[model samples]
Target: MNYKKRVVKNNQMTNKTKNKFTTHNKNKKYEQE
Candidate 1:
């Protein structure tokens, strides 16, 4: 049970990071233009 919770948490954290990274890249492109 605990292991499953940890796995889910890690997945959520990774997803958040991925989203933030994508947004950051978009912002960088706009700033360059």
Candidate 2:
């Protein structure tokens, strides 16, 4: 049960980072245009 909880936490962290990364890329694109 502890392992499963840890995996879920990690997944959330990765998702948050992925969102930040995507927004950063979008801002870069707008700057280039």
Model 1, 1-33: lDDT tens per residue?
999999999999999999999999999999999
lDDT of 2 by residue, 1-33 (tens): 999999999999999999999999999999999
Candidate 2: C-alpha lDDT: 1.00
**Which TM-score value belongs to model 2?**
0.95
Q: Provide C-alpha RMSD values for all models, in order.
A: 0.7, 0.3
Model 2 residue 29 CA deviation (Å) reads: 0.2
Worst 10 residues of 1 by lDDT: 1-10
Instruction: Return the top candidate by TM-score.
Output: 2
lDDT values of the candidates?
1.00, 1.00
Residue pairs whose backbone atoms clash in candidate 1: none
